[model samples]
Target: MNNRYSNKDVDVFAWFREASEKGNAYAQFNLALMYKRGKGVRRNDAAAFVWMRLSALQGIAFAQNHLGAMYYNGAGTKPDDAEAVFWFRMAARQGDASAQQNLGLMYRKGRGVPRNDETALTWFCRAAEQGVASAQALLGEAYAQGLGTKRNFQLALAWFRKAALQGDASAQLNLGLMYRRGHGVPQSDTQAVAWYRQAAAQGTAAAQRHLGVAYAEGRGVRVDLERAYSWLRRAAEQGDVDAQFNMGVMLSNGYGTHKDEALAFDWYQRAASSGHMLAQYNLGGMYAHGRGVRRDPAEALAWYRKAADQGAANAQFNVGVIYANGHGVPKDEACAVAWYRHAAEQGDASAQNNLGVMYANGQGVLHDDAEAVRWYRRAAEQGHPLAQYNLGGMYAGGRGVERDSVLSYMWISLAADAGDETACNNRKLIERKLTREEIGSAELMTRRWRDAHRTRTV
Candidate 1:
């Protein structure tokens, strides 16, 4: 019924059969490709493998490379890394850039070859010099990271730039980072954004995430929160864990859109499920506050602990709170003190103040006035109002060191200035007992301290 065969309906099988009878390697390879891709032929891996082997044996470099790939990927035969390596090396020695790159990857990953970065670098250099984009990118990374090469930022930038100009998405992203960090290039947010835009347009998920952050912070362009949200959403949809966490933040804070606590929780959960530490911390807070889900203190503690184990200071502080408050757990002051100490050492102001209170009250740790003063001083210097009040009390009572009424008034005044109502009331009582000259000295001390260390809000 379909006898009107056009030029496209040539007898490919007969033509290939006649060429095969003549021992034509090119025709054999073409026939293999036809079978492999089911183009004008039935897709038969066994037939493809047979023809590919015949073509490869005739020393066709492309055929050799394809045969190696087929062996490596088990596309037309049983997977055989050793065979893949052998064929790759054969094709690489024949000056096939792609085969050289594949051989380098195999050596680097120790698949059917001893892991040798130097050998991998050598092969990658060969392929890169031939203008293979992926190999150029790999060579750039090797130089940048000193993997089988001297650390050379200039060379890294050069290779990355070459590959990026050739439309290599990964190289484009790395080039942007190098520009942003001023590595072998003048730090230029504008240049960074240009390269990031290129890679993001190419659908590189990491590049999209970086571009979103740049837009949000006005790094290279004017701050456009809506643009940031759009870019971040694109990356998040592609399963970029960090982008997912950022989406949660933007959604929760209503940045560039209406607030959606429920959606924020969902995004946070997605990232947290991927083992993102900050996402785990945010999820803990969501569970604690019942923002999108029902309040569950135990669930909050579980998430907090997961993040804490990864050295999240905020999560560590929350863990201390959970232990101290006995929220869905037995109240263990000692456990609370341990967790508080962990966070305090990491420069968490609230944790330092809480640790100071524990020492002052002999709650979990041994009662030591000096320890209390030390912790309180640490937090107070960071402009923590509660720490300022507690430190002032310690100074006034002479509990840790000699009584210093001037320092006590200075600290209390600072706490009051920061809007601590109790500090204001205490300052009023303390000022009545001071002479005019003493009050002047205290005020001068406060002014000097404030000038030296500007108070920063938590």
Candidate 2:
């Protein structure tokens, strides 16, 4: 009986092999699958490749698609993108949805052809119309971003919904983002959170990070710091830069756990090393203040410069202060002025005030009283007390504007109200110079200015 069963099994294998040898494309394709999967045959990828190629050459669309995938993935042969594209094109022309999607990816990435967003979009549309979930998602992203056509948020939302309903994790994550940002749909944090939960369960790192932030801020959910930390840590461990930065913040502030500056520093270092601008800035602060690490001015300057190069205004200001004070290097007033100007142009009040001082003292550039007044006025209008005091002094000295005792007294009085001790003394001294009528006008001007400018927190 064992011998008879063994013979029957041999005959079953022979039946397909016989037909495959006779140039039957279907039989050849079936034989290849059997060889590849070791179903009723010993596994042999090389043999599978041979049979698959034969079937593909005979115009079998399914076999052509499988052959393309094999070449693309280097299965049973060296990877050859050109060959993969050729086979994918063959099957795609025959209306094979899988092959169409594969061809679109190749065009999109320039894997086997010149990158062409328009062509990729065309192929993706064909595959998506045929109900390919991944193709639908890709089409949605292209529409959302205006890759090959005008941006159409409604179309993107529709495609994302189709893919997300099919359980595509990436589609779910993007749908969540759209809902959260109110793009193409009414803003609904609850709906966003619901979709994020689904994608997070599937291990989508970006979705996990968003969900954690939602929990931390009590958006769409009650405040749950513990849950927030847990989700953030998961995404952080997956190498998500934003999540890593958030982890550092949570640890430093002891928001969901015990304060651990050491761990915070570690997280900040990881994100900074990955080129995160905010992480670099925070790392510099930790080094500058000796928080969770040894105080190292040089290290602080290095990190600050990295962030400054990435256009962080605060980092530029910090870099200026370091250069001016000779903290980590020789004092370079010229360099300090350059860095200060960078921050000042970005509307940094402290930087504007410092730049005004530099112009007044001719420390880094030629002394220009008008330029000093220009910067001082800008800062003063933003409620900088020191700038107000400096502007008052300039008026008193007739160094920037026409000397006006009433204007000087008014500015000095405004600075005094903000608790500038020097300005208070100067105001009293200036009062002696002003006539009683001038003093009354100055007092009235001070009251008007005070009412116009609400106190601004630094």
Candidate 3:
């Protein structure tokens, strides 16, 4: 609860005097913990073993747990899982909630005995009933996931609520998500923000990330760039890859701080090293654009390929673009088409657009206007600006489908509305095409989309 050792300032020899003279259980337990940890005493396992045994003999629950853990982890004692289980059972029987939870975990994992889900559940329930937040949360997960129990969402919600109310940050975050999405709890953004903020303030990484998102997007919490950036930065410093990538984005934007491309590069590198896919994609972009470092097409290609291999859609799309254009690697339209198709299947609109272009041009595979229209339509449905423009172009030219002037004009209007500048400008040449109303609608949609999904906290 506090700093690890409670008696950090006390002398061990003096403590031994008081402990041995009075046969103090707490003093014995404390001494043994110290000895086991070599905190204020020499690292002597035999001595620690004897002290722990003495304390264990005195029937101190905490001592029982410590002794059990020592046996479990072989600290100051020979490895003996059975003995650990014995001591743990002894402590658990005495209503030690931590011991109860430990015993449950042991049984579930078969650490000291045969795997017994029923026994594990029994011990978990015991600790859960004692108001151990971790135990309650674990029990909740077990019930919800049908791990040694029935899958019961209601039971999960009940236990999660119990643990959440107890100020367990993990439970608070989990329950907040449930509330935010109305999964087993009534949907309430306000309630979600309250719980998320509480856990975020307590330094929970996931909660901090969620809070950053909320602040950035003005969801539940009013838009606060500084607060969002601070929370994201805190999480990033804790080795959270997602946070690192988002923090990089903020650094790139000069929001609430100067735009420092080098810092952005550093954060991106951190996240990339940790295998954050988005960071890998962004890292490639940095190399391609020469934002923070010298431009190296080979390095950009390498990063894009790495992320593409991990099934990152944007990375795949970029890989296709670079390969097709011979920006980094030798010109290979076939390779570009392959990557674009892979990413398009994962719903990358840019990839779909590029794939459609390849099909229309016959740059790699056989030229097929029909396939072009198909791919363009897929991306257009998801509001891809370029794909919408191309799909409208196909409709107007009757390249794939039959000519229909009215339908062709309608598609151009939709493309312009989707924010395709080319589609809007071309409408001037295509008589009676997209009206002024379509362009205004497209602008509004694009702004909303950008604001709703913050690339970073800022």
Candidate 4:
């Protein structure tokens, strides 16, 4: 059996006596903290204020900071931002790093003072230089966004690396992103995978999800769908929204394990209940499709509307599909176009491609080939396969772009190689007219693209 009395368990009168007689600053501070936390003693704001004031008078920087927190948080007392600032300044001037960083947050959030990004950055820099991992990450965020200083990816990466090395999970994730994106340094998928693994091992669900994605895509390590699916499951179990959504899909499709629609629906429900927009959209899909439950268009529409209200692009597109198909409701082309437009505004490649098709066919909106071409181009830039084929056809036929058989041949064949049936038929037609050399060049590019993107599992 363990017999221990926490500092919070001490009798107030006994502590006061010992503290007053011995002039024990640590005891005084601890007693003050107990009062602040209302442990063992009746909660009394005035008493906490008096005890912390006494300890602060003894040059206890910790006590000063505690007082600052109390004032800042308005715990058991009137909110006094100015007093909070004063106490924080005292402790910060004493070289207290926690106070410095917290004060910086206060200034940044305009809690105790006007929002002064510069002051926030300066204080964060000071604390970061003092070897505070939290402050280092905060400084990195500031530099990354140009909040107070000029945006500097290099500097942000440096600070994030330093903090990440010190076991800061958020910093680790940021550093991993920089490695994956080649923002400050040359892209190193290997390094990104390493950092993500470290953070994931520390129980970071976001890192687990990203690491799984890297594993699945073979960004650095050999692709392993089993490992990716397992990692995603771990993150999903911990309530990670993105992981939950992705895991639901994997379960529904039997990507790395046995197909289990019931499990997929359960996971989707868990994530959607937490206000995860994508999960909500996916839940709606399951209901609409009758994959795991009886088909219920009303329930699907309700979930789709929830996700759309939260500004989820995929949900906006799904809502449009539901309206157009009259899934469990009367068909409404006007509403379909409206939802499609919302998804299109958010740069959803599928929505852009579909919306363009809708316009061209006059299914839900005005027939306009030019508008169709514009939307298709937008989707093409995002690597949407269908849009690439559509753009190639437009170029070849002079429908919405300048006629260019050479470019059309390249794109149509490119799409065909990626499994587009229509593009393949057009490719067969173009192959006979083109010289062998032109065909070879297009073939090489298509092969290269396929080779670069094919996900081979380990």
Report clashes for each candidate as comma-separated counts: 0, 0, 0, 0
For model 3, residues 306-421, the per-residue Cα lDDT tens digits are 89999998899889999899996789999999999999999888888889999999999999999999999888667676777787789778988776444555556666765668
Better of 2 and 4 by lDDT: 2
TM-score for all predictions? Answer: 0.90, 0.85, 0.75, 0.70
TM-score of 2: 0.85
Residues 70-170, candidate 1: write the lDDT tens digits. Answer: 99999878999999999999999999999999999999899988899999999999999999999999999998889887999999999999999999999
Ranking according to TM-score, highest score first: 1, 2, 3, 4
**RMSD vs true structure, all candidates:** 3.0, 4.5, 6.8, 6.7
- For model 4, name the residue pairs that clash: none
lDDT of each: 0.93, 0.93, 0.82, 0.84
Q: Residues 159-265, candidate 2, lDDT per residue (tens digit)?
A: 99999999998999999989998999999999999999999999999999999999999988999999999999999999999999999999999988888999999
Candidate 1: global Cα-lDDT? Answer: 0.93
Predicted model with the maximum TM-score = 1
TM-score of model number 4: 0.70
Off by over 4 Å in 3: 1-31, 43-64, 71-96, 106-120, 143-147, 150-154, 164-167, 383-385, 392-398, 403-458
